[model samples]
Target: MTRKTILSAVGLVIASFAVLTALNYATAKRLYHSLTLFNESVIVENFSNMSDIFETVEIEKTAPEHKFGQAYQPLPKTYLYKGEKRDTENFLEKTSTTALVVIRNNDIMFENYYRGTTESDRRISWSTAKSFLSAIFGVAVAEGHIASLQDPVTQYVPELKGSGYDGVSIKNVLQMSSGVRFDEDYGRFNSDINRFGRTMALGGSFDDFAASLEKEREQGEYLHYVSIDTHVLGMVLRNATGREIADYFNEKLWSQIGAEDSALYIVDSYNEPMVLGGLNLRTRDYARFGKLFLDNGQWNGKQIIPAKWVTESTTPDAPHLKPGKRDSSDINLGYGYQWWIPENADQEFMAIGIYDQYIYVNQKAGVVIVKNSANINFMDNGFESATETVEVFRSIVATL
Candidate 1:
């Protein structure tokens, strides 16, 4: 070979190596960013800009957006907690709330943004996305896609056979009673939930991760808060409908809701929506969903979700699913097809997400409040923050 030709080949190889190195570095940086995403200094920004840190699928908003009537009222300045009148705005600040929107009777009573976020920012839904997934699942079932809630999930997602989800009924999974053994303590670095987070950061398949789990007990006996159960429901929805979740959800719910801006779902490596959580939307849009549920799945005089499904999914119909302290459940809150029923309920339910995200609906009071927070102290004192937040919501509704 000629000397000049050999040198040219060597230069080409060197250029390729440099390019690969740069790509590897970029990937590593992104992974690191995702790993430390919840750090106190950056969590607020991270929650609002998750699309930049992760792969996402857009749920497009249709034209003729549903606008809420505005009747701006100042939030109650004080809320009672444990017989003490605590400052309401101070509680919001201490909880690191990014946004709060209060809606009553299809009108926005109060709305505000904080922590360098705006009305346009799409805040991460976290586990509150489960309620959204549950809503669309009802649509699939109503359209004759899913035959029955009593059918075993394996009947739809055969891929889950032999996994923890095998022999688990659709109803049991919806109630988070799948008997799947999962450690959801997000504070622990080596916990299953945290490992799942890392899987997203490193571009791993959520399906594979789910299929790796083994059952801990029989299905439908106890109320365990297994987040993956909701993911399995997503798989079933996709398999039953034979359509991508985003497209189906947009057609069935998002498009019908009159959302002001396009929402997003943080996807896994294979572009699967993280139906367990990972929904992102503006706070107003979140309240719109809350309002939909408050109105028994009706929006703007049109029935979006079946009224029957709405009632069944939000009410704890079985003893095992009832709220309050119980040995059969890991949580004191009641379970209802991905919705939460708080103790001493007064026709109220909520969709709660980690780090203090909540869509609180009070049916009798005609209030729907959307609260988004980056509360680093969420796990402190065994989640007293959540209890306190719920009390705050109740107090606010009482004033209205």
Candidate 2:
């Protein structure tokens, strides 16, 4: 072929590929809830959409931000996931991982960034923010702002009156057992949770959406993962403490936890923080929170979280919330206040989010691993399930 003819052929191939990519995006976007940033073409178009979905509450760092000590340690040559040995690069690629930070002995042992992310990027926490809200509850309880766990949530947030949360206790909401019927299907366009996302995307009131949910079962009857339960917790905190969630978070947790940077929380039309999720922070700052939990809420000679609250929040004290008792098929796990417990755990728990975000805490091993990803198919394959992700963290901690 002549030079010009060959060049023309290559251009034609490129144009065809671009057309195919656009077609894929159009189809996937029709099922918009499932169209994630993991798709290369979609991500290129919609990656910035996260910040646009909601207004943000800035958690300012008070003077003297706690800095993490650098004592870098190399990762293990290989770690096992699903009975197969894998290297670090393979694991990151498979999970669509963005950042991984391992903290051992109060130091950064291993930290890696991927997909153009840096150490300073304030990656969205997704549902992992639930754990942060749970921690904030500890502070509220300690300060006497929240009188008791058994107190009815309606006592504080009377706005939930006549709704599913009418008679639910604060603890019920914390444990995801308020028994509200919410479809948390991430793949379904019409799921209730995705509808909430759509509402937030357009500056709708989260309080109104939460209060609109009808009751399905008796409160505290059985364990069900209704995320809006966490929003109720925020309402209780807001009423009981007479403060915004962002200010409380900064005063109670962020300022003293040795966080190197301020974090951001997505807000609603009423300026209510999205406590159910929508917390964004640096990976190292996330590890700081994990380390605080591992140390029983102590950081730098200060008890940031009450030690007793730490114990109660990490253990599945409620009968139905037991790891093995609640559900079988895939979620062979228990839940605490807002934390997830692995089966047969030894003082270990995790804060997980959809799309593969994690903060795995192993108290026995003195390890806290934080992972951030944009995984679109996290729920599809058995290997990519949350259970298998725990196995990966365990293997890494074991090698350390």
Candidate 3:
């Protein structure tokens, strides 16, 4: 109880924290150096294995439906990538594709698995999971839970009182134009995105980390890809609905969609769902999600998502998200509510993720393609890139 003893205890605690921080930094740097562990093997295990770093909330199983006619009919033999035509076989090999499934009008046109994966594997959706959250938001809006997309995020999530999101609207977050300063390079250990990952790994809170962000630009001024923006959106949605995300997902969309197996979401130490990219579902189930959007939020006979919400969600009306350079398409892209639009495309949008995961919806062709990969070199430019994967999806749809 002496003053000397109290000072000693405080110093010891500080020293322990410093040592743990140094160790975590070293581990992150070392892990980033290995492609096999950081990219390939970890991705394979992310689906089949996820207990060490995550606490999961189960998505209740859905009643199955005989929705698809048959699978693996035939696909385009060749596809063009980076201005060169290549065979489908080579493209899959080069991209490190783990699973590929093509669904045309509710019938499987092609399906295949590689890299020790099977049809039943509950693959992680990565950022592609953002679209799933977007879907739930749409239903929330229609039900009057979230008054409007134009509402500021802090209106519902008061915990973000004075952070970068203090003045950002839900629409800006959905469009990824929150103007928060964040570096998303997965290969960089010290980058903001990686630091966020480290926070989760070390039992830090996603919301607290997000609320700590500083403003990089005026709200809605730029179209930078800030993953934490989606987390804020999820935070608002959860607060408004007053339900666990997994339970709400089951009630509103998943259970009605006829998912063959239970889907899963990775939660943080506080048990809050990682709404930015924690969704894990089967390949066919991903296709079913795409079909829901294609149907304009209709499934079988029910309007699962609001028709108006569906239309507005895909339609990028904001000036920062229009299909033009001034609208931020120097990368040959525009963005929707939570979707991506290719340069000069007609009625086509996609859900994409890092480490090469996608749900490509070509509504014009009535086709949906779900491709998942563990490509460590996804950041590599030239032929093997996310853009080229879109090209491959386009080529396949063209052949159909």
Candidate 4:
């Protein structure tokens, strides 16, 4: 080859190398942002903007929306915390709360947004999405799509057979007692939950991640807070009904309930809804769900979810699932199918998510309170953030 031709070939190779390097840099930057999305500095923005950072499937909003009535009220000035009263507003600020909505008698009593968020922002639901899934699962059961809760989960999702989920009853999985040995400590970089987050960031299969777990104990013997158990329910729902979770959810729950806006679920590489904790919606919509359960699955005189299933899901049947501390259980709060019965309860329960998200319902008081937070200190002091938030809700209810 001539000298000029050789130089031209070298230039072409140099250009190709530069383009490859730039692409790699861009990928690395994206991966870093995904991994650090929850950092204290950016968590507030990140929580409300999850769709921009991850793959999401939209749950379309339905027409003739069920809107809330306005009866605006002020929150209580003080709330009890560890037997000491603290300023309620200060507490909210301390916890990094982004949005709060209080509803009673199907009306919005108080609503506020913080940290540059608004009513339109679709806040991440985190694990609270499990409760939403539980509602839809009830629909499947009522429609006879699922034969029985006593049946093994593998009967629906045969892919889970030979894995940790094999032979585990659908009921046990619903109750979060699947006996799967999976570490959910988000503070640990190498914990299973963090690994799962990484998998989402890198486009891995959530189904495969769940199937790779190992059984730690016998099913239904104890109460274990396994996040993956919810995902298994999603799988069972999909297989039993032969439909995608998002589509089914829209048809049965989202559309039927009259959502104000389209919500989203962060999906995996295969477009599977991360039902364990990937739902996103406005704070008011969360309260709407809480209201649905508060009214025993009725919305505007229509039976959206089976009333019997609501009763069954919120009531802990087994001793291991009862509140106020137990050797067999991992938490002091009582466990139902996918709901939480707080200690010293007076017909109250809640759906909780990581980083301080809560949809608390008080039946006796006819109250529903939704709180969304970006609390980086959520795990500090043995989760006092969550325990205290319960007290805060109670105080507000008393005032209402």
Predicted candidate 1 versus true structure: per-residue lDDT over 279-300, tens digit per residue: 9999998998999999999987
lDDT for model 3: 0.81
Q: Which stretches of candidate 3 lie over 4 Å from their true place?
A: 1-42, 324-330, 382-384
Residue-by-residue lDDT tens digits, candidate 4, 114-164: 999999999999989999999999999999999999999999999998899
Clashes of 2: 2
How close is each model in CA RMSD to the real structure? 1.5, 10.4, 5.4, 2.7
Candidate 2's displacement at residue 317, Å, is: 1.1
TM-score of each: 0.96, 0.87, 0.88, 0.94
Pairs with backbone N, CA or C atoms under 3 Å apart (clashes), candidate 4: none
Models ranked on TM-score? 1, 4, 3, 2
lDDT per residue for candidate 3 within 1-400, as digits (tens), equals 9999999999999999999899877546434432233555466765555533355788868677547877566777888766777788887887778899998888899899988889988887889999999998889888899987789999999999788888788988998889888988888879988888766665668889999998888877678898988899889988999987888888999988888888888877788888898888888889999999888899998999987877777887777787656745234567888888876778888898887889888888999999988776788863247677778888888877
lDDT of 4: 0.91
Q: Which structure is stronger by TM-score: 2 or 3? A: 3
lDDT of each: 0.91, 0.81, 0.81, 0.91
What does the lDDT read for residue 326 in candidate 4? 87
lDDT tens digits by residue: candidate 2, 1-400: 9999999999999999999888656444533633344465554123224554346888877758666667786766677765787786676687788889988877787899988778878878888999999998889999999889999999999999999888888988998888788998877879998888877754469999999998888877678778899988999999999998888888888888767877888888788898988887888888988999999999878888999999899898867878874442235678899999988798799999888889999999899999988777788864246776787787778877
Clashes per prediction?
Answer: 0, 2, 0, 0
Error of 1 at 31 (Å): 2.1
